[model samples]
Target chain A: MRNRFNEQLEQLNVELIKMGALCEEAISAATKAYVEGDRELGERARSLEQDIDHKERDIESQCMKLLLRQQPVAKDLRAVSAALRMISDMERIGDQAADIAEIARYMEKSAILRQVPMEEMALAAIKMVTDSVDSFVRGDLALAHSVIAQDDQVDSLFLSVREKLTALIAGGENGGLCLDLLMIAKYFERIGDHACNIAQWVEYAITGDYEDD
Target chain B: MRNRFNEQLEQLNVELIKMGALCEEAISAATKAYVEGDRELGERARSLEQDIDHKERDIESQCMKLLLRQQPVAKDLRAVSAALRMISDMERIGDQAADIAEIARYMEKSAILRQVPMEEMALAAIKMVTDSVDSFVRGDLALAHSVIAQDDQVDSLFLSVREKLTALIAGGENGGLCLDLLMIAKYFERIGDHACNIAQWVEYAITGDYEDD
Candidate 1:
């Protein structure tokens, strides 16, 4: 029974890494689609979202089953619950990517692009997501802490982009388009926040301390 | 030992409800401050936040003790874990209210209050928080479900306020004060989201299902 439980735990870790990879791919696809104004890529992102959702549900059930069957304690319990919480953040990350894709679709229909700062913001957000997940997989607390600090950079970029869009809208240039751009930036900012949340949860799994700022 | 466990659970519930009440009050105070441009009320909201934080820590420790000592299962486990989750959401709710108060302070400093739909949004958000916590106290899934549905309304209200503010800024009529107003509306919208989160967790406590939209 002990060996079986350990095997299941190992499998859970592998699946979570896979899910993290999917989340990263979705972020990249959505951002590339929006940045390049590719309708086909946007369409692909929409379909891929379904796959991400399925993976999230599957991973959740797997975690639940492990909890019920293994009745894990101490470090094992923390690791399992950490996986559960990380997946919630991952699912939100997927939603953020999908949200950006939907905005891409809208931009395609409008034939007007607000600015390229949106792409820069998306890139920064994706970096945060990638680094945080990597930290989780490697059990790197130092990397996780650094990722948390990097969130400020993402937030600053988001604020700057928002200010720029607001200024453009105030100037009465592509007002509606600028609003869509603002919303897209907002989505990326939230993606960064979710990444920060994952990093924080990872730290909690390691040290049993949770902090909110 | 069983009675002691029951007493701990009761204390947890009471602390959670107390935190909830404080969240509701701070939101109410923040809304009043926004509506009336009352800096004093905003100050009161900020002062109340520290108390909420203290209560959150107290409740969390109580929960950890319960988990370690009682080793609760099934329904009891759900209730204790649910309370822990609820406190996290409640703390976030307090943060949002404090955010609104900060916006109120900004408005006060700018001295350019045009009374942009902030009060309306605040009232709606405060209603959501109140109903969500009341549902949790009563364990009413119906109320929780309704709160979930009402979140869409909150989002729409937030959008409308944003649109109106953008229009105001575009027309250059509010002397750039519209941006501050927009931030306030966004704060209230986030408060509503936290309220919805609390309601969702309450439902999870009762049903063991996490519903996401």
Candidate 2:
């Protein structure tokens, strides 16, 4: 019975890794879609979001079953519960990626990417999401803390993007386009925040406490 | 033992209600600060967010204890887990309200409220938050659905606010102020989304399945 429970926990971890990879793929495709003005890539990201959503539900049920059947305690219980919280953040990252894709699909023009630091910011956010999940998978405390620290970089990028867009608007650029760019930047910032949340949960699972606590 | 578990569950419910009430107060105070240019009210909202955060930690531990100690099955498990999810959304509502208040504090001039549908939108969001939590406490599916439907109203109000703000900016109004107002509108829209999330969880707890599932 103990061996079976261990196997199931391992399976849960595999499922979480898969979900995290899906989120990474979704965000990467969405960012590529925005950069290349490709609606097909955006559509691909949306499809990935559906898959991610299914994975979330599947993994959530697995966690619930582990808790109910195995009645995991101490560190094992923390790991399972933390997985539950981490997946929600992962699912939100997928949703935000889809949101970014949706915005990309609606962009009548795509020059905003060239005019702002959005590409770099998106990449930073993507790295944060990927590394945070990786840290969770490996229980790497240092990597998790690094992911948390990278959030400031993403935030600074957002502010810079905002400043650039504001300057464009002040210079009589199309306000609608600038607003769209700002929204995209904001979405990337939010993705960073969600990634930070995942890292904090990772910390909790491994160390039995969050950074703030 | 069963009666003791029920008592603890009731205490969890009461704590959730208190947290929901804090969310309502935070949003209300923030909106009032925006409307009246009252920095003190904004400060009050910010302070309330700290209380809301503390309540979230308290309620979260309670749910965790109930799950671990009682090992509740079926509906009882659902109720405890649902409370876990609901508190996260409620905490987000508080954060968004604090975000709005932060923007309000920076608004040196507050005539923007008179220029847009922000007041109505803020009020609508507050109603959704209150109704969603009430639905959760009472296990009212119909009320949950009602709260979900009201999200469209808040969304539409957001579009209207954007249009009005865009018109003002196009008419050579202060771009910075218009942008700040737009940010405030977006925060309210997010509050509505969080409320919708809470309502969905409420539905899940009561029906054993989410609406989409």
Candidate 3:
């Protein structure tokens, strides 16, 4: 029974890694679509979001079953509870990625990506998300803290993006377009927040200490 | 033992309602600050948010104890899990309300509330939040659905606010101020979403069905 429980725990890790990969793919597709003005990539990201949703439900049920049958205690219980919390954050990351894609689909044909450092910001967000999941899969507290630290960079980038968009609007650029870009930047900032949340859950799973911040 | 569990469950319900009321007060205070340009109300809202946070941690520990000690199953298990999900949403509502208050603190002295129907929007969002918690406390599925339905109104109000702000920017109003108002509107919209999330969790607690939408 112990071995079986361990095997189930391993399976949970694998499923979470799969979900994280899908989230990364969704965000990358959305960012690519936004930068390149391609609606197809945005549509693909939306589909990926659906897959992430299904994965969340699947993992959620698995966690419930483990809790019911195994009645895990101590570190094992923490790991399962942390998994439960982490998936919610991961699912939000997927949703935010899909939101970014939806905004991309509605964007005007003219590229506004050049006006702001959105591409770099997107890259930073994606890396933070990837590293967060990596930290969870490996139970590496250092990696998790690094992912948490990266949120400040994403936040500062968002402020810079806002400043640039405000400058564009003041310079008589298209108000609608600048507003849309600002929304997209805001979505990226939210994605960073979700990533940070995941990292915090990972830390909790490993150390049994939920960092308050 | 069963009676004890029920009593504990009732305590949990009471705590959740307290948290929900705090959320409503925070949003109301923030909105009043925004409309009146009162920094004092904004500060009050911020402090209320801190109280909400402490309540979240307190209730979280209670739920964890209930889960571990009771080893609840079936409907009881569902109730605990639903509480787990609901508190996260409630906590987010508090955070978003505080975010609105922070924006109000920085808003220009000019009255932007007259230009948009933000007062109506804030009221609608607060109602949804109140009704969502009411549904949870009473297990009223119909009330929960009503809260869900109200989200569309809040969303439309956000779009209207965006339109008005866009027009203001186009007409040579302060772009920065308009953007800040837009941010505040977005925060209210987010508060509505969190309320909707709470209502969904309430449904799940009562019916074991997680509504997908």
Against the native complex, each candidate's DockQ, computed on alpha carbons, is 0.24, 0.49, 0.58
Candidates in order, interface RMSD in Å = 3.9, 1.6, 1.3
Per-residue lDDT of model 1, residues B14-93, tens digit only: 77778988998999988888777789999989887878888887886676567666777777777876786678777767
When 1 and 3 are scored with lDDT, the better candidate is: 3
TM-score of chain B of each: 0.93, 0.97, 0.98
What TM-score does each of the candidates earn? 0.83, 0.96, 0.96
Q: Which stretches of candidate 3 lie over 4 Å from their true place?
A: none
Q: Which one wins on lDDT?
A: 3
Q: What is the interface RMSD of candidate 3, in Å?
A: 1.3
Cα displacement (Å) at residue B105, model 2: 1.9
Error of 1 at B77 (Å): 4.2
lDDT of 3 by residue, B183-211 (tens): 88899998999999999988988898998
Give the alpha carbon lDDT tens digit for every residue of A1-213 in model 1: 889988998898788888888888888889878877788887777766777778877886687667666777777778877787788778778877887899788674443353546767877888888888889889999988987998998889877876776666566665546666766777888899889989998898788777766
In the range B1-213, model 2's lDDT, one tens digit per residue, is 899999999999999999999999999999999888888999999999999989988998888788878889889998988898888888888888998999888876856569798999999999999999999888899999999899999999988988887677676666667667878898999999999999999998998887641
Q: Extract clashing residue pairs from model 2.
A: none
Stretches > 4 Å off in candidate 1:
A1-5, A38-77, A107-116, A209-211, B1-6, B36-74, B108-115, B174-176, B208-210
lDDT of 1: 0.78
